[model samples]
Target chain A: MENQQQDAEPEDNSWLQSRVAELENNWRTAMADLDNLRKRTVRDTVQVRQQERKRAAKELLTVLDNLDLAIGHAEADPKTIVAGVEAVRAQADLAMSNLGFPRYGDDQGEPFDPQLHEAVSVVPAVGVKPGTVVQVVRPGYGDAENQLRPAAVVVAKAD
Target chain B: MENQQQDAEPEDNSWLQSRVAELENNWRTAMADLDNLRKRTVRDTVQVRQQERKRAAKELLTVLDNLDLAIGHAEADPKTIVAGVEAVRAQADLAMSNLGFPRYGDDQGEPFDPQLHEAVSVVPAVGVKPGTVVQVVRPGYGDAENQLRPAAVVVAKAD
Candidate 1:
């Protein structure tokens, strides 16, 4: 029994060496995959950005086309062209909303939040409370975390 | 010496077993990392798309604001307003180009390429070569692979 056990030791050691080699190979492959995936992530991010820009630009083209038509007709009737231009403006707003940046502003009497509002000027009014939004100079778009721009606002001054 | 070797056999086997367990744990961790990375990739892709859309939309808002201002000024002086609207039109074109979809078409008398130009109408002209673009009905944007729309063109008919 002792002689048989001694003879089996060499085979057992060889099996271990093979197992280690296999595990090392697998670990190397996994590391390589991770490296490759990291590289691919960067490339995909750039591609995705370009794709989205192109998509949003395409949406805006309809608005541009309408503007062009309105301008071309402006030579005929200025009154009708104004109405057409207003419609085109509304279409542009819709396009922006569709692109996921819904316009937000005109919180007339709401408490001002810095995250969404930038106080460009302060005004004192009898009916308005201090720190409240009295007027929006420019409307902002999107939510707090993903905001494109803060609403330029006039806040009620503390009396 | 033989007795010492026999005694060390159990220790060597235990060490090998521990090594195998450690390797298995490492492999599992790498797999978990890969799984987590995949989930992050999906989340990041969505984030990137939204970010790009927001950015592109923000760029468009200035153009829309300019259009609104031009329209508002239209009633005062219709002739000057036409020039103002023309400037706004140029601004819109720049915005599209900035967004990576520069306008194409208006290649009058140039050899018509089906990839960028859509033959909307055929015209027989005396000087224009056969299969050449005579007039552009509508302009296209972007390169072939990333085209937003094909330019609608009038191609000269084969004589």
Candidate 2:
């Protein structure tokens, strides 16, 4: 029994050493992966910022192009300035919508909610219901979850 | 001797078992870390996109506000439209510059370089050096590293 036990000890020791080595390799790999992820996160932060900026800037360039075109017409024909500007205004609305901020001026006659609309002045209006939005002084953009600004509005006065 | 060897074997086996358990725990934790990182990266992508869009939209809103103001004045006073439009132009230029895209129309009279300026046309002029920018047709924004567009220009005819 003693001879058998002694003989088996060498093999057991070697197997344990190999297992430890395998674990060490795995541990090292994990550590390296963590390090790599850390580095990548920093690089990704900068890359994402610049990429988003470029995208936004490109969108704005469309607005600038329309402005330039409108200005050009203003110089050539004074009569066309208002028409050109109206077209530009529509273009801006479209641009804002494309950028995830839909215009919200069409909410007139709707019940005013504190979350969506800011009542600048309560106004008495003939045959208008109280707490209803009579007019939107300035249109809001985006939604409740991702709001840019609430619509500045005038609500009907309560009798 | 057999009794001694048998007694040591159980201790060694228990120690090896505990060591293996520890290694398994560590490996599992690392795998969990990797998984968590992957999930975080996906969340970050969406967050970054929204954050950047909001920032860009805020900047654009200023330009929109100026446009709205100018248009409001247009109906009341047609004569002030051009002057109001010119101010809006300057405001647009300021807005673009605030977004890291300074207008570069001031590059006229300098030697034309293909990198900064795109020569749309070339013409001969007395006392003007070859490769000089005779006119800036349209201005550019930002610089080489962070450029929005190259300045469009008409250069002097190279002799």
Q: Best by TM-score, which number? A: 2
Query: Which lDDT tens digits does candidate 1 get at residues A37-132?
Result: 889999999999988988899888988999889887876876567677788888888898888777888687899999999999998866877899
Compose the digit string of candidate 2's lDDT tens values, residues A57-152: 777778888888888987999888878877877887777787798888778999898878999999886687888899999999988777888999
Q: Candidate 1: misplaced stretches above 4 Å?
A: A1-18, B1-29, B75-79
Listed per prediction, chain B TM-scores read 0.84, 0.83
Residue B154 of model 2: what lDDT?
93
Leading candidate by DockQ: 1
Query: DockQ for each candidate?
Result: 0.41, 0.37
**What docking class should model 2 receive?**
acceptable
Note the residue pairs that clash in candidate 2: none
Q: Tell me the tens digit of each residue's lDDT in model 2 across B1-96.
A: 223324355456456556766887887788789779878987897788788878888888888888888889988998877788778778777777
**Model 1 error, position B56 (Å):** 0.7
Worst 10 residues of 2 chain A by lDDT: A1-10
Cα lDDT, model 2, residue B5: 28
Measured with C-alpha atoms, the lDDT of residue B125 in candidate 1 is 69
